[model samples]
Target: MNLGLKTAVAAFALTTMALTAASAETRVTYKSAKTGSSYYQMGVELAEAMKAGTDGDISVTVEESQGSVQNVMEVRARGGDYVFTTPPALVGLAQGGKAMFEGKGDPAFDEIRALFPIPSLTMHFVMSADSGVTDISGLAGKTILLGKGSFGATEGEKYLDLFGLTDQVEIADAELSNAVAALKNGQIDGFVTAGSYPAPNVIEAAASTPVTVLSMSDAQVAETKRTKLTIPAGTYAGQDSDIATTSLPVVAFTTTKMDDDTAYALTKTFWDNKAKLGDTSPWWNGVDPAMLSNIEGKIHPGAVRYYEEAGIALSDAQK
Candidate 1:
């Protein structure tokens, strides 16, 4: 071949190589609203798993807590590639039921879809047993610190309403740590938190001062579940033991607009390596593949693809 022809062919090959390299690089960012919490730790694990599962083709950046509201906003703005949120948050977004979301107008929830529903989270209406606080209904007229910007806050209110104690209780908004501290300092009667068992924060307080986890009778559980106030097993760390408690369902979600291939790949990568992801924090030990995508709103096409490929049937809505 002529030397000039050989040089032109080599340059063409180099350009093609560069294009492939760019296409092979995928950058996806995952943000969780619960910063410094077990949820964030789980996200980090999921992010790492996704990176490794994709054979380094897909890269993930995890930023904990931009707040659930903000996370939803980011997803809508096309700023965030993915996020984790609770069922109430998911339902509120899907149904435009943001009667309590602070700040700007509600985003379009119909645009969001469930990636999975983590195990149910027991709603701990915490107080010192020494304070004579046993049931949520007993905390009437007392200050209750509920975690802010979380579905826990909504659950706490629902708990109050479910038990006909709404008018009896005074809601105090505070961060998890601060609320726990407030209870310790006698500023508030108790703090309400919802999570899978041995809820780290609630356990932290329980370890310090003896606290009681309330389990209203089956009748109450039914009412709370129906009304959105709840506690669920696996929420406490010692589920293998005799501790029995019901919990509220907490669903995690992502946007519906994501392409099917991306969602499918993301879901598969995360679940396949889920065991390793939980190693970072025991909080994720409860995440089950069976629990994935079990709540309201239709599953995103990507999620549907993953489930179907795995031999799970897709719902009619998903189809």
Candidate 2:
């Protein structure tokens, strides 16, 4: 071949190889709850659905994390491409830098962008029936396990503060599975867990021993209006009555580093295959396209464009 023709052909081959590699797969990481937790399971399911919906163009790796607070920090540090977190934690970190972000020397966390809202998490304060604790008031002067460095732990402290029991009760830090084990062995009076109804850890503990899922007092519920939630009747084993408590909205978010095309594609793939995703877990049943724009942190511009194009109005908060 002529020298000029050979050079042009070699450049074209290299460009073809690079384009092939880029189109072959896009690897992304997802930070979720600790292993064996509901949030983690949901992340796995989402990763699967996304891969299938995109025809394997996107591959998501699910990494175990300490739930919302840790996930937020990880996302800020670019530890993962996507994260499962709560709205309150995102708002606190982004707007006021409160809670876990307080005095952490990090500037206000405004770079994270919301993708979509998942299920709402209901806080459960489960006590051993044998502990002689029946309600929130009985937690005083007793040790309670709150998942350390987790969103649950922060909320647990807030509940104690609102009820004037912070000084009276002894606070212990542990993960959910360990906390349940502690409750079973009488090492702790009660432990706080927040997630969708019929949390696996709570169910596993209730099956082995008698457990009391405590309810918040009317006055206490009124004090924290933002987290008001209820555990409906027949939601858990051995629990026949509804328990009024606190709750928070769980959302999926990504950082500003995510490209707009990828973000838009991921968002579209999720909603397009949402029904199939919901079939895998009840947690997805609560996901509403209309609620996508209702999230606290700024919505991803790609997601915003997708929703707007689909005729879904952006809430004032999202705007």
Tell me, by lDDT, which candidate is best. Answer: 2
User: Candidate 2: misplaced stretches above 4 Å?
Assistant: 1-18, 33-38, 63-88, 95-109, 129-134, 138-150, 166-189, 286-294, 309-313
Model 2 agreement with the true structure over 159-221: per-residue lDDT tens digits: 889888999998775676698778878899888887776677788888878888998877888
Q: What's the lDDT of the predicted structure labeled candidate 1?
A: 0.66
Name the top TM-score candidate: 2
- Model 2: lDDT equals 0.77
The per-model lDDT (C-alpha) reads 0.66, 0.77
RMSD after CA superposition, every candidate? 4.8, 4.7
Q: Which parts of model 1 have CA positions greater than 4 angstroms off?
A: 1-15, 63-66, 73-76, 79-111, 119-122, 129-154, 165-176, 179-189, 195-197, 225-257, 289-294
